[model samples]
Target: MADNENFNSRRHVMRVAAGVGGAALAAGLGVLNAHAADSDGGRARRHGVRTYVLVHGTHSAGAFWTAIGRELALRGHRVVAVDQPLHGTERFVPAAYQTQDLRALATEPSPVAALTLDDFERRVTGVVRRAARLGGPVVLVGHSMGGVSLSRVGNAVPELLAHICYMAAFCPSRSMPSLNACAASPEGQHAITPLDQLVGDPEKLGVLRLNWRTSDRRDRAVFKEMICAGYSDVAFLRVLEGMQTDESMTAYDGRAVGRADTWGRIPRTYLRFGKDRTVATELQDRMIAEADALTPDNRFTVHSVPDAGHLGPEDPARVTEMLHGLRV
Candidate 1:
């Protein structure tokens, strides 16, 4: 995090997203101080103060949580929105992407195509360990595909995470062994995905790449609907600028089940995005139900954001109020 060169490079890539939504998430993670080295990072909650470690979803970066991170910070909570692999600071922008060369973009090989769930787990684990040292209870929050990382990290260091919040994210367990399985469930049938705008072949390219910068108006409209519906055109476009084009299919399809004795033991919460077209509200409920059934005693205390879309034009105050309501 002390690497200023990488930080500058990340800023260069984010010029298009103008706002780049949550890239400031990395800004807050600027450096780790003495508290990081001396603390064990796995102790249980000791007070009312809370440290939030935000994890972003797939084909996206931690910048998506910019406003929320700031809001949490302003409310006196420590915020560390860690940049996952192939995102934020690690983002790789293909040359063809800038040229908008369709053929080249489709066939061009990506450096992140080979990354797996293990890569994501390792990256987040290190960050969470450091975050636990900063203060009170560590409330780890994940959005969209980020839910998988929450589960894996929680299982690995359940003692460190005081609470895990899945904000309309995949929480695979029991019969649902992976995120892919959860996506294929009957409840996920209505998801408005980007399959039509996808580039290349997942099987051949080893990644799921989208043409997020598409010039086609129809494609852009669909992207808006799948992402931040009801938000202004300008808001949607700003989010598009910060968006990435590729995600690791290997990681997307990897196992993400949380063990009962580990992840299940931690207090868990779920915030359902009622207007989520991407994940579908039905699927969100299903994941909560499934996980609750797996651990009846540790059932998720669910909440709802009825007006917000998937990657929202966030009502930070509303979300923050809801977060503060968590019993954990």
Candidate 2:
């Protein structure tokens, strides 16, 4: 269904990404990420607009980037926040989940079971290729599991991309061929694995299914601690309501290591989140280190949000500033 999608709905994204209003965004944000209108589009942006291909992680849809995309769109950049395979409008929200039927949920014949990382690759690659045709440089942004698709697509069509960015996301290479490998590393020790929240065995179901709506307080707590660490109960509930119940296991197991000549040629940025326990900060550092080792000359242009977690909804305007300011 994601046949060469583009940001035809960018106007809509701009409105939403401008979200929370100037009031809420100004509430607790610190000096650097304050909500004050920081309108100077940096470097490449001061010259001309660039195309941004946004890839969301598992359990969420294109709506996941609505707020962020909205900000980029307002800055006059083209934002294509893609819905990865079996995600977004294409998501198969299981019936068992809605009815609170935990028993049925465990074995609900997941339509996403047969799905592999190949499906993800096909969707993102098509979007990136189409964006390339629209002219100007294409900047690809990936978060969490979305990074897997980013690496695969980068390998498939390296020349089309001017840059790739990972925000508290995985960046697999020879040293880390897949996300599981990244988790198995020593630095990954600090991460909060989703194992406790799983509904069924991955081998049995061929997918890593979650019950994000589980009534269990402990499970909810684990998810909150891992994802939006400092959020209040009401805030975390809003986050939970948007989560999907299943994700392809093969997507995580897939060999997404970028080719040295292809993916390695493109410049990259790793926006590390200091408070991200889901994909621990140390683990993020490990990924950047491994990637730099793979391509010594073209290391990541690193940045950090010491106060931000995995989902920096509080990133204020910093994310928009960095994205708008980026150059090849």
Candidate 3:
């Protein structure tokens, strides 16, 4: 946690997620003001990894890496965690407001056709280009959506990655709809986010909506503990406040159709969380099988961890161990 002033700059809206209230959000802000007043942790070691950007998954923020970032820094790795753009707006747009937006979208015919394989590859290539400018070969550790994004990146620019790792990832092979893969296997079937809870329409393609608003203390507690447990509360809430519905429908809807000609060129690894409630071991193996079958000449490895859920990298030591061995 940095000094509180670092977090107090008034944004467009007040914090609205994670069951936080004005008092709780204020308390966290106080903590941050005190922390940021100090310094940004410590400087990265000279000639060490110039930067390591860790991208988070859906419904997540950069704060998810509190422990992981600290550990990597101790090992002299400069860590930068990016809260991926879910909704582009900086202000919190409540469902009531978003409803009007959705209604408008629903009434209008979609301007574009379904996303093709090339579109997926292009989105990923953009991420890699950004990464390369930050520093060459930044190790990519993607979980869920981040994982899916990386697959595209790996396909388009294998030469740009120092290492690629997917943690309990979301992967749909070419010639298959993402849902087809999910429903095709038991593990995948069990992992679908509840329909009502899903933030976007699966059929309409590019629509995204704010879907989580339950006041269930248990659910909120579980989310807080599992994801942002060690993060600065103010920072965490800022991330939550900044959170928006993700564009998964477009990213996930149809068959990828064309085989990625790029995966054959990258070295990749998969960490399958054995007890993963989301992406399961069986599904991971299926994905691995598909990957291997597609690229017989490529090198790939899968490691298993017992008891860890979908967010396996939350275990600092385990993730560090796995990440330390990878190379460009």
Q: What are the models' TM-scores?
A: 0.86, 0.84, 0.63
Q: lDDT of model 2 at residue 326?
A: 79
* Number of residue pairs clashing in candidate 3, backbone atoms closer than 3 angstroms, sequence gap of 3 or more or interchain: 12
Best candidate, TM-score: 1
- In the predicted model 2, the residue pairs found to clash are 17-67
Question: Which candidate has the top score in lDDT?
Answer: 1
Give the 10-residue window scoring lowest on summed lDDT in candidate 2.
Answer: 17-26
Give lDDT tens digits, candidate 2, residues 171-216.
8778778776776667765766655466745556766677877888
RMSD of each: 9.4, 11.6, 12.2
Greater-TM-score candidate between 1 and 3: 1
In TM-score terms, candidate 2 sits at 0.84
Model 3 agreement with the true structure over 27-68: per-residue lDDT tens digits = 111000101111332322224353455655554445555566
* Alpha-carbon lDDT, every model: 0.73, 0.72, 0.49
Stretches of candidate 2 above 4 Å error?
A: 1-47, 313-315
> Between candidates 1 and 3, which one is better according to lDDT?
1
Model 2 lDDT, full chain set: 0.72
